[model samples]
Target: MSLFARLAFLMLCTVIPAFALASVAVAGSECPAVDANDTQARNSLMYYVCYHQSSPGEPAHTALNPAELPEHIKWTPSQGHELVFSQTRSVYWIRLNIRNNGSERRLWYLNLHYPLLDEVTFWRGDQPEDVLVTGDQHRFGSRLVDYRYFLLPITLNSGETRSITIRIHSSGALNIPLKLETPEEVIAESNHLAVTHGLFYGAILVLAIFNLLLFFSSGTTYYFYNALYMVAMGLFLFAMGGFANQYFWPENPKFANTSIPLTLALCALAMTFFGRSFLEVAAHTRADKTLKAILWICAGFTGLTLAIPYSQAILINTALGLVIIFILSIIAISRWQQGYQPAKWYVLAWAIMAVGALVYAAAAFGYLADFLARESLMQVAIGGQVILLNYAMVQRWRLLNDKLLEVEQKARNDLEYKVHERTAQLRSTMRELENANRKLATLSLNDSLTGLYNRRHMDNILPDLCAEARRTGRPLTIALLDADHFKAVNDTWGHGFGDTWLQLIADILTRHATRPRDTAVRFGGEEFALLLPSTDLEGAQKVCEAVLEEIRTTSVEAPGGAKARLTMSAGIATLLPNENQQEFFERADSALYEAKAQGRNQTVIADT
Candidate 1:
């Protein structure tokens, strides 16, 4: 079965489950200390984990005013526990107290750590009306600081207690780990995180190069697949780490949000193939079929990520990805049981990656909470897994090289038949490509509606047609045709009937301008043109009369079954000596205006 089909079946058979830790709360006793002269300037504000949920229905925050919050709102001491809630539309309320007991009042910045939250609103001081709002969903300008994480700075007075209330909500996982930081601490930590992410990407790049070198040296498809897997994982990691938004494209949040599924599908595609190759599943009928289906599905999914909403795509991708990883792990372990040594490493690598992915996915889905679960845990797991997989590929290459040498010692044999078969395949592909190109070239020149030369092709051939008239000394006739009362028909019967009327005129022009050197063009909108290389104004007028007669005889039904007859007015001009194509065409256009002025459905020959 296809991976999509299998996933649908699995989803149908099993209930979608959510994981969430039980709420821990102690009323009105949690506070974090602030000192001006502290050597370590950053503190985890792990206290006052009070929550008032909304929409999904929990108690609303009673304490909008900081001065009287202690009396009205029950504050829950977090006991250094992480502030986590599952993916909810409900606005969560969290409160914390900061006391600066030092001689000097100091300013501190508070960062919520999670970057993907949809909204973060902070209330500080005695003012009930002041709220600082910032989040990924908000414009970048809304944040007090120019950072990816939600950050707001607050001032602490000496020997004074300050109450802080934060309201946060998201369409994604709500894992809030707020930190109190001095200016230096925030800068130092940001730098540290940047270095860590840089190392992560650098490792991926080096590993990709290492595997590609192995491929070049060993000439094995194994190395190729290994390199591809690392590259895809690298892309996924860059987007997941928020580096894509931070450095590459800060302004485009939609692209940043959409990049998740794009990279996820890429990594998923690589994993499906790499696992299949490592397990040698193609030799097994049923196992190979599953792997192939997974490969195809992941490829299709990567393309679909562009058109679908990011939230829906991310949810579907995360769920299906977990299922695929589980299946691959099972396959690897099964192969190891069958005595495949490479499968042993495959299982180990898959385990590390699977655990990390599960942790990240859990946090993303609102089942898991903690900064470790959301960030560092998965990065460590992926870093370790990439190393293990690289080692595994090297081992495979080593064994393969040994086998190759042993085989070489026995004999070297090849056949002309294999070359012949490959050559025949190449020939067939080439022939098909040539035919397709020819068809495309023709389609590019011709108008789809009228099968006449479009303006683009006419522009290309106009100079040549002008040159031909000059060289042959033939009276080259240029006619610009317009459907009479075209706009009136459009107004009466709508655009569909208008198109029919234009097509009827196009057909009449095609039949009348049928000389070997003549060309018919649907120049633009309702305007048609004819180029007759050897026809004078008199001869062109005859052709124009014929077109007029055809239009008079022909009739088409409008939308409401009204008989619609379309007539045409045209201006015919023979090429003038020493005049360019533009000048000649303009003179013809002037004549067309004169024809419209004289009467409806008549030809006016140019006197210029």
Candidate 2:
């Protein structure tokens, strides 16, 4: 070839890469070596990280598949910190490589430390079928690992290198904080965080109880509002730290998005209530009126969150929060100057919270370093605020005790002491009775053996259900199911094994009727009934078949290492127009009999 031709080819090669981008692929060389023997868990993922950004919307995510990534895409090192992105409508794809250089298979835990990313998807390049998709926009249970954050299990065989691709999209600023750790390290961190959270919540509970007790003793609603304020702040702290996702409302992702708005509103209201009561807003009408107005506006903004977009709701909440804090600070300082002893503590607590919220917001907006935005930092400030407020209440309690001591009237003190003791006894006895009543109520409505709703509960609910179906004109279907070959099994493996077989059937029934309106009842021994609200004949049949299929696939282990496949025969009937409760029940029951007569372990639909 001529020298001119060779030079032209070289220039073309270099120029093409700039336009057709491809991020550095995760390969054997790219996967950094780790000291497996070191047995330490830490932020060990930065060195193996590379990232590419795509334009906003679903198309960007779809366009940047691992195979279709632009050849000229540039990748930069993470440098021991998260890749922080400004708040914009963009899709960020992160890549990491791991190679198992060991002689045996190994598993590592991967955690994407940020919790608020709207969507996150993880793809294991080598395992085509095992892509994991989860994010805040999805239910908490949808995550592969049930941790609060985006955690996943990564496994590799000896000499195997796997590339992991993560796609994240959000309107909020993005922080790509990834960590790879051993199983022990993961467990250790989990336990430590759990313990710390337990202490935090426990402290809040104690403060609430103390304030509540003070309210009861003094007959002052001031303490009552303070207790409520404490509770609200506790919830806000938990919501911030993703503990609410971990424990309370995991399946409700839509509600999770609303939590911050609702929490801010509730906390603002509680603060307003406590402040107003303590300052006697009726007496200080002018100063307190603006506070009340701001609180109401916060409430209005919170309600808008239900209909409006999350970003707008968040902005409204933040603005109201800042305004409320500023006004409250001024009021608290003013009250302290007027010699209100508790106001001093309130002022201090308010200042700390303001700082926390500011830092937290800055981090969220990408103004501060990503490392400083851990929800635990916010929790610490909240905890401190709660402690300071409680300390002020403790002082009040001490003063009250001293005043009682000063008025040393023996008979009055004796009477008061007796009343307090008797009150405690009554409270304890009432609590015990309430607990017993709850258990008794549950027992009355539930089957003793199967833990499903009893036939009596089904009878109670069916009439109302039929009436509702008539009103709404929505189809309501009922399925009556029974286990097949019951007597032969009882004779073969005794009653105990037969009981196990029945329990297995009950489990399958329970799985299908999971909705709040759906009811699974233990009609009788080895007989079950499912009430599918708003379900048509076809849907009811599908549910019954799913349950039956699950039972058929499951093996019941009998005594002495013997196992048998469990099966159920189900019959479905949709409620007809003008059908009474009895007619509906009878129709379903007739279908069940027909199913038994036709063939066992099969589902049959009632003739219209």
Q: What are the clash counts of all predictions, listed in order? A: 1, 10
**Error at 607, model 2, angstroms:** 99
lDDT tens readout by residue for model 1, 469-492: 899898888889888888898898
Q: Over 4 Å off in model 2, which ranges?
A: 1-42, 57-64, 281-284, 370-373, 396-608
Worst 10 residues of 1 by lDDT: 407-416
For model 2, the run of ten residues with the poorest summed lDDT: 12-21
- Write one digit per residue (lDDT tens) for candidate 2, span 202-298: 9888988988997887677878988888888788767766778768898887777778667877777788777777654545466777777876876
TM-score of 2: 0.58
RMSD of each: 25.1, 31.0
Each model's TM-score, in the order given? 0.58, 0.58
Give the per-residue Cα lDDT of candidate 1 at 264: 85
Pairs that clash in candidate 1? 28-75
